[model samples]
Target chain A: MIRRPANLRRFGLGLLVAMPAALVVWWFLAAPLLVPGMAPAFAWLLQLIWPQWGPAVEVNGNAWLVVTTLPLLEQPLQSAAIPLGPRRFTAAFALFWGLVLATPGDLPLRRRLRQLLAGSVLGILPLVLLMALLAFHFQLAVVINHQPALTVTPPSVHVLALPYPGWQFHLIGVGRQLGVLVLPTLGPVLMWAVLNRRFIRAMIFTGLLSRLPAAAGELDHRDGRA
Target chain B: MSRGLLIGLTVVVLAGCDAAPQDLRRALAMLHNDQGAAAFTQLQDLAATGYAPAQFRLGMLYLQGEVNAERRTLAERWLMRAAAQGDVGARYYRALLWLSRRRDADAVDAGAQALERLAADGFRPATLRLAQAYEAGDGVQPDVAQALSWYEQAAAQGERRAIERLATAYQNGELGLERDAALAQRWRRQLAREPFSLSD
Candidate 1:
């Protein structure tokens, strides 16, 4: 079935390449929406504008996740921070999709198709990370605003409870909050292992593709040579 | 090599690739793991070389009554050193220590003068203390005008206590207030509605 992991590897390379671009998009897109005279506080501006992201986070060797308000009530949620926001997604999508559609015109069919999908998926990273960061900022906003009692309630919400051990919720809230804030720039890191696997596979694919004939060179060339 | 050994070695290599990050992480871990004493020792080593955070930390540790030995003088010294480095935390403590010392009203004009300097430097605690001195005629003659001004400056810095004082002062026409009901009502509303803002 084209090997699911092989499919994922290509996805990660595309994402890594797109991360910086996404950062630029996030800054440019969200900067205008910020309150006047608030120059250059990327995290604060992002959090203020799209507070749904919660707050930025840092964890596990600078790894991160930028959570947005898709509101899954998820457990063991990812968290991170970086320069990220909503606008980057639109810009990355357009860039990746544009490259993908542009390739089919001149490149070989299989190569062109795969490149398109890889580009599209990879392009989504910047936007995905941005959305995640914005969401995290908002989550932090809520926490700062609510100062929610750090009590584990039915596993739905993890509060950072004090003086009481055995509570996963508090750790989750603190970790995830940190994870999401740092996730935008760092979220792509999650894709590294996946990307490494893909790169090896892609190299294998390249080896095989180059070794194999290009559709057997239409076969008629052999007859003509004879 | 056997596959398992190879895999283990590869994992070890990947894990050890970031030694610096690991060390920094370990240091941060000490900070969070309630090894404050150990952290303080390392921080003090850094502080001896004039690290701003370390100085600020030492100052705060002294001013704040932790289980550690009470070293008020050392606290002020470290706090001053860090404050001179423009560390906000150190500056905060500098204001605190300066304000903490109580003096008989007219006997120590120099202490009050020093407080005025801290107050002008955007230290909310100092501003409030100076205001109190004016309000109570503690160090100088009770000058309602100076008290009101100092209170306003402190209020602007989000000191809730000062905001409350200013609100009350304006409301009661105390501290040389001319009984301007309009201004008093405005300040009070600003406090109630915008707990942080300086104006209505």
Candidate 2:
């Protein structure tokens, strides 16, 4: 009954074929460079924030950096173990979004590849920005939460209510709760929606969108934008 | 004669097991009772057999320099033997011994290397010592960043000296660090939370 079941089926097949290959490329090539590359950038940002708060920074393997931050008494301690959680953009998500943006209709293989490559860059740029912001927020949160525990002598105050700036707390709250948890999967879907708004509208109304109440007509406007 | 022979055989069997345990127990008991010479005698027998605890105790007695004139030499011998057997106290004391020689470069290096290994394993005192060495350039190159790193590590392990040092460093911009009063106050606030003990 669907007008473009073949296209959907073809996209699924293409996804199955391309996913593993993409993962292999990301793991072997992209990850090694990308993960460690975050360290100096993170350190620089921290230094800019607090000129005197430089700690020993080093990359641990290729997946993350274990940063020893702050001195207690006069010794070093691990303040944060920052990991580059690449699951969001590395394998399944990348392939699924690529297929959605590339071969949404009955496009030829060359055209599909061109669309896929272009859409991937556009989709990944937002993700990369989100990751960098999250890293900064995450480190700030860690220090705020753990600062009191790194004590030498008896503390006069029992607890510190707000360790970081007021804005930092809000930033961390949003970054951790929304950006880190929700955005990875949602980002690709949203990106795909932007790329192929028409196809999404046609598919949705024909399938589940038709079953929804009259209030769902708002989505029709979105579909028309494509 | 046969009954007497049997009694003698039983006594011999009882004595066959190492008497080091009993000697150690007696030594501790004698020391507890304030009988220092008796304890020393008991410790000597067990220490001669290369018992680590006895050796460490004997080394401490000599290191105290209260019992004899050749205390340093005797302390070195016993502490070295105990250290070879991986006694923590012995290792710490031996490192301290080397560190105390302010003018001896070789001694400082030896102490620094030993403490560095311990520091890497998250030993608080060793971490603090290593940080100081880096800060002062006693046995190693003067690297304020490295000192800060070590101080941070020690602070993480709840070392009071390291924590205070960090707060001071941030406050005064010592150790090649920039002055940050906010961080200094933050650490100062932490110092108020619980009682810090040197023994910790």
Candidate 3:
């Protein structure tokens, strides 16, 4: 029972207005608070994965500082710190919200809000977590490879050994590159498509509506005009 | 009209994100999406027509995923062509490919020589790589003095790897250098000032 052409215009205008507003709100309000708040979770995860490193995470503004022990060759444990900006992975949250808010106004407000909550928890959160882990591993590998005194063993069958194998570094490299380049832009679009499949189909396939039982004769008059 | 507008907007966004030519950008997008065969088909004509970026990208594709001797040779040829056109990335990767042939002493020497030239041009990665080669005696002789000098040069240019190496070397008195806590502390401070980024 949705109107064609007019609703599409509304959707476009809504997107144009909402996208930048969402991005601004995210950058100033949400990201600054959320990224810093993520430090504890990341610290716990890193500690679980790499207990030998004795990972300690601290927040400095929006960035997380990870202090860890470096096991150099024939030397006592040396301290090193790596800084990570979670904002890079969290921008998709804004994009997803923008798309959700821009859905056709005819839809129930409560349903839209529900979709927003689901998208945030189900899609964006997992993406941010995965990207952070990949980025952290890649950064640590680079640091380990740079240290001349650290003896890295050759490629081993065990992938997660303390002294990382060469192939693991390569795998981390590819994962990091994909996380940095592709996921930020594509993740939101896919989420929006999944949530708005009905709306999308109605907009794209007006001719096919005549064959459906629900709105068969209802859309027939407009099909020729469309 | 709305559909047309959406398509237009998508094209504008994609084009605005990258400064590369439209076709080359499409090829790169294909490659990113793991459409290797399609990307190869699109890039071949551009690379044949002497587009340096296309040559470089095509060469990189050839090196990807279970590369054999034939693919390596093709990669080298395309990389050399791109390097001749002054693609810095191609030149660096070509040197790396040469260095990977460790059993071939001549190739190793050639790679080391390429790295030295790139370092002289103030490419930070090249400076760091040359220092590592000197330290590990990968292709060059194990000269502690040369390694320290190259590491210093790279560190001065704000290369994080070189800074880390220098900090460790000075702290441990490794690489035949006298232990200097002050220098190590200075390098560590510099390292802390360097921002972390995923890009090389």
Best candidate per lDDT, number?
3
Better of 1 and 3 by TM-score: 3
What DockQ, between 0 and 1, does each candidate earn?
A: 0.01, 0.03, 0.02
Task: Answer with 1 or 3, whichever has the higher lDDT.
Answer: 3
Report, to 2 decimal places, the DockQ of model 3. Answer: 0.02
Q: Which prediction has more favorable lDDT, 2 or 3?
A: 3
A130: Cα error in model 3, Å: 1.3
What TM-score against the true fold does each predicted structure earn? 0.44, 0.40, 0.46
Model 1 Cα lDDT, one tens digit per residue, B1-200? 69999999777555424232223233334765888677667656656877655566556555544533358778878878976876544554465455445553332555566567655654445677788878887646688788888888877754556767766766777767666677777777765654221121
lDDT of 3 at B131: 91
Off by over 4 Å in 1: A1-226, B1-36, B66-70, B102-126, B136-142, B156-161, B192-200
State which candidate has the highest DockQ.
2
lDDT of 2 by residue, A39-113 (tens): 554444444453322322356674444232222322111122234453343443454444464444766777656
User: Per-prediction RMSD in angstroms?
Assistant: 17.7, 21.9, 20.4
Q: What is the C-alpha lDDT of each candidate?
A: 0.49, 0.60, 0.73
